[model samples]
Target: MSDPGLPPLSRQHDRRLRQMYRSAGWPCQDTVEIELLAAGLLERRLEPSGREYLRVTDLGIARLAQALDRNRAALDAHEALVLRVAEEAQRAGRIAYRGLGLLAKPGERWLQLRPDVYSIRNTSVEDYLEPVVHEIKVRRADLLSDLKKPDKRAGYLALAGECYYVLQQGIAEPEEIPPECGVMIASASRIEVARLAPKRPMKPGFATWMVLAKAAPCRQPLEPEPRL
Candidate 1:
């Protein structure tokens, strides 16, 4: 539970947080939009194009000022990219999330390597399951640092049906990545597929299937019915 005085922010609040502040163009599924409106944090106004716009309000600013500490706890660059990419993938029918929907084993050892982020398309046997894995690289040094680890390559290739390197825009060029892997840039306002990842299934172990079995639409079951 959150402190009585603190503005409500926790793991349960991620969807709400993103709903209230993500780009107006970004899709929202949670009731956070409505809550923000009720709290006077957001106003439902029309854009020049006649589309509804949920712009922040002065009262919302005041509320946010009181939530400065909580906001700081909630926002971070690495997770921000993960959130954007995950949300985008969900929109595209990808739901299973690493460390979320995709759970690690009860007593896992160093041999099992988890992708920074990943999603599964479907779980049905006859249907082909698309496993998309992403390695979030916020800093060039972090990217270079991981490059030295040979296991990272072997791990991703064995688990991901399609692999992607999700980096901040201008952080690295698409040419830096191989033709098989895709390159996605997380821009300030949006996530762009700078390069499409090629599809290739890698034979995975039983541990991998365990993770895929848990794939669902979004973390919030009541939210938008995941198209997945």
Candidate 2:
């Protein structure tokens, strides 16, 4: 058979290759196995015990390194988009919080909801604290997957005075999001507000209060709220 042209591997493919590099007994998915073999990234070798095992070749390692580099670059770019949104919010005098985790209960450590970026306008008892949540969507597949989680949106609505979807240009249509949600676009040059989010301040329950409490001063310095 002729050689199959090697393309940039997905994160999963790169992970599998790394697993193979570490251990010959690494489990292989059918598609990954076929692609790795065809792409000349992996091979089956007989061990001293006569057991056949999969291993990543030098070429595979090189490709995995390249894949890792690409993954890092993509992550950096995505993070830049997130940072820009936060900066905009802050410039408007909103206190920005990135990766704020909302839990169902104060005792639980698990996240019930995690908005990519969220902000609270002012910090004190001055006026009603308006919470705005931002969900960043860089890929359409990821956006579609998130839209399926109605509970997440509902959770945000419970706490948010406004919720906006910060997305890549053309990645998602405004209709794809719920009517209650607003949309914004983050591109190479600037972040634009396509649809302004309506203010619908809700009575924040204990959990929502916990989210805001954690957002104070800075996202990193604040600790999780103690169980009430």
The estimated TM-scores of all candidates read 0.55, 0.77
What is the clash count for each candidate, in the order shown?
0, 0
Model 1 local distance difference test score: 0.64
Model 1 Cα lDDT, one tens digit per residue, 33-134: 555555555677777978776666676556556566555643477777777777777777656474433322323333456676777664455246677788
* Model 2 Cα RMSD, 1 decimal: 7.9
Q: Least lDDT summed over 10 consecutive residues: which range in candidate 1?
A: 100-109
Question: Which parts of model 1 are misplaced by more than 4 Å?
Answer: 1-75, 100-110, 202-204, 212-228
> Which residue pairs clash within candidate 1?
none
Best by lDDT: 2
